[model samples]
Target: MQPHNRRTFLALGLLTLTAACTGSHRHDPDGGDQRPDPDQPVRLRAVAATDTLLAAYDALLAAPGAQTALLQPLRAETARHRAALTAGTPSTPSTPPPTTTSPTTPPTPTTPAALAVLERQTAQSRLADLGAAGPPLARLLASVAAANALHAAALGAPAEPPAPAATPTPTGTTPGTSAPALQKALSAEHAAVYGYGVVGAHLPEDQQRTDARTAYAAHQSQRDAWQRLLTTLGATPTPAAGGYRLPFPVTDPAGAVKLAAHLETGLTTVYADLVADLPAPHRPAAATALRDCALRAHRWGAPDTPFPGIPDPTDPSPTPTTPTTPTT
Candidate 1:
C-alpha cells in the first residue's frame, strides 16, 4: 500500500476505537445542558477545527490592502462552515462552563500555498474521523475530505489523500431497479450545463469565456454518463428541467464567475451524497467525481474550506473504496 493509504488506514482504526469507546449516547433534543454530550465529543472537535480555520480567515481579512479585500467571499464561506458545524450556535448563559482542553489545533497556514497545504491536512484528518462517525456523518466527512484533497490539486500543491494510481476495481454488484444517486447526479449535471450556458453568455473575455465553454462540455459529458448508468440499472432517468432558478442575478463577468463557483460547489455536495449510495467497488469513481467538482469550483474562485461539503460553520456527504471512510 502507498504510505498515504497506510496512514489513512491506521487513522481510521484508531478513531473507530475512540468512537466505540464513547458514542453510546444519543443527541439531546433539549439545549438546557451546559455540559457537553459525551457522544458528541468528536463532533465538538470538528466544530473546534472549523472555528480555528475561521479565525485564520479573520486574520487574513485584517491584513493590509487588495489581497485581503479579494478574500471577502472566502471569509464568508469559512464563517458559513463554522455555523454549520454546531448546527447553529448554542445559546450559552454567562456562567463559566466546565473545561476540557481541545485536541484539535487548527492549521496555521499563513501564505496561499501554505493555506492549501493546511486544507489538505484538515481533509485527511476528517477522513480518519469518518470511520467512527455514523452513516450520515461519515458520508459527509468523506465528501468534505475529498473536496479538500482537490483543493490541494487546484492550488498546485500535493493532494492530501493521495490520488489513486491503480486501475479501478470493477463492481460486481448486480444492477438493481433503483439508482437514485445516478438520477440525482444527472439532475445536478443538467443544472450545471444550463448554468454554464448563462455563465458563458455573460463573460466576454477570451479566457473566462473559454472556461465557461469547457465547464459546459464537462457537465454535459457527466450528465450523459449518469444517464447511461441509470439506463443500465433499469431505472428511468428524469429529464432536465427547461430552466433552473439562479441563486442571484448574474449581470456581469464577476457575477458569471460567482455563479460558476456556486454551481460547482453545490455539485460537489451532490456527488458526495452519490458516493455513499453507490456500491463499494464503484465508490472510488464517485469520490473522484466529487473531487473533480471541487477542483472546478476552485478554478471559479470558491472559498477553499478546511473541509468541503460539510457545515463547519458554512455548509455539507460520502465515498470511496479507499479502505477508509468505512461507511455504514
Candidate 2:
C-alpha cells in the first residue's frame, strides 16, 4: 500500500475500535454515561442535605420558647420546602432494599423520590417550635412529622434516634395552641407591606412602579390571611406598626430601590425558613407564595443570601464561622 493509504487505513481501524469501546460503556436511560459508584455518593450527599436540614429544624423546634405566633407560619412554610426537596419528584430506586421498615426509620430513597418528605419534615419541626399554636398549627406539624417519620423508615434511617419529642403544652394558653411565631411572621409581613409603599413612591412613573404596587397588594393579602387565621384561633392579630424601621434611610430613588430590594430579599429568606417547616399537604400553597416572593425580590433587585440552589455571586471559596444554634 502507498504510505498515505497505509496511515489512513490504520486511523480508520483506531476510530472503529474507539467507537466500539465507547458504545459498550454503561449509561443511564437518559443517555448520559456515568460511573454508578460516583452517582451513589452524589445522591447520598443531596439526600443527606435534606435529612440534615430536617434534623436541624427538629432540634430547633425542641428549643425552649422557640414556638411563637410570628414563627408558626414560617415553620409551616419551611416544612413545605423540605418536602419539595425530599419528595417533590419521584425517582427510580437505584438500590432496592430487601424489606421496608417502620415509617420513622425507612431506608433513604432516591433523591427525587424523597424531596417532598424532606420538605414536610423541615416545616413540621419549625411549626412545633412555635408555641401556643392551634389545631391548624398542631395538625400541620403532626401530619408532616408523621409523614417524615414514615419517610425516615422508608429511607432506612435508624429508628433508634427517636422521633421528635412532643413539645411542652403552653401554660395559661388554650390547649394545643401557639401564636408567637405567627405573630412574628405577621409583623414581618406588615413591615414588608409598608416598605413597599416607600419602594413604590421612588420608582419612576413606569412599569417598575406598577409591578411594585402589585407586590405590595399581594403582601397585603398575605397579611390579611394571617390576621384571619389568628382571629379564627381566638387571638387578635398585632396591628401594623405606625412606623417600620428601615435597614437604611431612603434618601434618594436609589436608596428607596435598595430598601425595597432588601425588604423582598429578607422576606424570601424568612419565607424559605417557613417553607422548610411545614407538612406535605400544605407545602404546595406555601411554596407557591415563597416562589412568588423570590421572583418579585429578584425583579426588585434584592441581594441574594448564602444558600444552596441560589446563584453564587462571589469567589468560589468556603468561609469558616462559629457554630450557631438553629433558627426555626
Candidate 3:
C-alpha cells in the first residue's frame, strides 16, 4: 500500500480504538450531558473508522495526478467497510426497555434505532465538514458525505436527534410553486456572477485575472443550473443587473481580493438558503454545493459572516445596503 494509505489505515484503527475505550454515549441534541452505557454497542467506533478511511481516500483524490484506478478501489473499500459496519446492527423494532440505573446511564437499547441514528448523524457531520473544508477535495468529500448522511437518516438512525418541527416542504413565491429559498438563492447567484465580473475587471496582473476568470466560470455554471431549475418550475430567474455596486473601491490587488471574498460570501449564503428550502431529496445537493462555496470563500480570506440563519442586523432598514460600492 502507498505510504498515505498505510498511514490512513493506522490512524483510523487508532480512532476506532479510542472510541471503543470511551464506550457508547449518545450526544444529546439539547447539549445536555451524554448518557453513557457500557451495554450500548460500540458500533460507533467502526462507523467512525469508516469515516476516517473515507476522508483519507478523499485527500488522496484531492492530490494532483491521482489515478482513476486507485480512486475506484478506494471507493469500493469504503463501501465494503460501510456495509460491514451497517450490517452488524440491522434496524429492528425497539424492544421493551430495561430499567436504567440513572438518567445519565443509557438503557440497553436494541440495535436498530441507535444504529440508524448514528448513521444519520455521521452523514450530517460529513456534509457539514465538506462545507467547512476547502477545494476540489471538499466538493467530492461533501458529495459522498452528504449521500452517506442521507442514507443514515433514511435507515432511521440519525446522528443528531430530530428537531421538533417536521421537515418543511419547499415553498416559494406562489403557493405550491418553486421554493422561496430557491428563488432567493437564484438571486444570490445572479449577484455573485455579477460581482465576480466587476471584481475580475480590476485585477492587476495576468495570474490574478486568470484566477478570477476561472472562478467566474464556476459561478456562471452554478448560475446557469439555478436558472434552468427556475425555468423548469415556471419562475423567472432574477436577471443580472447592468452594474452591481461593490462594497469597496477595487483600486488595487488587495481591493480585488476583497471583492472576490465578498462574492464568495454571497455565493455561500445563497447556496445555504437553497439547501434549507429544497425538498429532502434535493437538499443534499444544495447543501453540498453551498458547503463548497463556503470552503472556497474561507480559502480566499473572506471574513466569516455571522451564520446566515440568524436575522441580518440590517434587515429592518428600508434600504438595506451591502458594503459600499467602489465608484470608478
Candidate 4:
C-alpha cells in the first residue's frame, strides 16, 4: 500500500462523512428541493384563464364566415399557455383548489367585439396571476399576459354595438387583504378604458393611432383582470358608467393624444397603489404592470413625473385640462 495515497483517501472519506452529517442534502439556495414549489398553485388560476380563452377562440371559429386563419394561431398560443400553466402548477391534495371553474353560463356564439372582449378578459386574469406567482413561473405568466394583450390587437376593429358579456359581479372580501386597493385599481382601469375609446376616435396623427391601439389593449387586459379577480373573491366589480365627460371637447387629434396620454399616466398611480398593497411575492407583477403602463403613457406624451405614480400633495400636478363632468 502506498502510505501517502492511503492517507489522502482517508482524509477525503472523513470530509465526506462530516458534510453528510452536517449538511443533510440542504435545499439549494437558488432552486428548490423535491418538496412541492410554493408558487406552483399560484399558476392554476392562470391555467383556468387560458382555458377560457381557448374556449372563446373555439366558439369564434365555429361561427360562419369568421376569420379562421387569423384566429387559429391565437387559439394555438392560448392552448400552449394552458399547457404550460397546467404542467408547472402542482395539483397536490393539500393545496387550495385552482380557481379553474368554467363560466357559469354556457358558451354563447361570438361576435368580433365579444371575441376581442374575451381576449382582453383572459389577458387581465393572467396579469393578476402573474402578480401571485414567484419567479420563473411569474415570468411565464407575464409572457402569457403580454401575448393575450397582443391577441386583442390582432382581433382588429370591434364590430357593431359592444356585446360585452355580463362579467360576474364581485361579492365579498376577506380580512387583512388588499381588497380596497384592488378595487381602486379596478375602478381606475374601467375609467381609463372608457376614456381611451374617446381618445381613439379623435386620434389625429397616424403614429398616434398606433400608440392609442397599444395603450387601449393594455387597459383592456388590466380591466379584465380586475373583473376576474373581483369576481373570484366574490366581490362585485364597479361597472363602467354609460359615458365619461372629457375635460375638453376632443375635437382634434391633439385632443385625442392628450386624453390617451392622461389616461396612461393616471393609471401609473393606480398600479403603483396596487403594488404597495400587494403581498411581497406579488409585488413584482404590479411593479411590472406599472412599468409597462408608464412606458405607454410616455409614448402618448405624458411628462415624466419624478416619482411616476406617487402623488406629491405639496407639488401636485394640475388637474387634467380635460373636464370631469358626466352627462348624457
lDDT of each: 0.56, 0.44, 0.46, 0.55
* Best by the lDDT measure: 1
- What are the candidates' C-alpha RMSDs? 13.2, 24.7, 18.1, 22.1
- Per-residue CA lDDT of model 4 for 274-304, tens digit only, reads 6546554445445566656665665677774
What is the per-residue lDDT of model 2 for residues 1-328, given as tens digits with 9 covering 90 to 100? Answer: 0111111110111001100000112246675654443223323333444445444444445557654452344344344434432321234233222333466653442342253455445435543333332223322233233334333333333332222211222234433233554555566677777677777767777777777777777778777766765676667898765433455676667886776666665554344344433333333334344445544555567642322112121223434232121111
Q: Candidate 3: misplaced stretches above 4 Å? A: 1-125, 128-177, 303-328
Clash number by candidate, in order: 13, 77, 12, 13
Q: Regarding lDDT, does 1 or 4 come out ahead?
A: 1
Q: Can you write out model 1's per-residue Cα lDDT over 1-328, one digit (the tens) per residue?
A: 0011111111111011111111122335574445544325556656555555556555556656525644555555544444444442244212223333455554455665766677677666665665455445555556656655654464458533323322223345634523766666676676677677778878986988887887777777777777776766667877765434566788899998998898887776666665556654455555666676777777799886644543332322222221212222
TM per candidate: 0.53, 0.43, 0.45, 0.43
Candidate 3 lDDT over residue span 1-328, tens digit each: 0011111100111001100011113455576775553222333443554554455445446667755473545345455445533331333112212232556433322333443454444546555443333222233333344344433333344233212211223345324334455655655565666666666757765776776776677767766776776666667777644433445566776787777776665555445444434543455556655545654455467653322211222223343333322222
Worst 10 residues of 2 by lDDT: 13-22
As for model 1, its CA RMSD to the true structure in angstroms is 13.2
By TM-score, is 1 or 4 better? 1
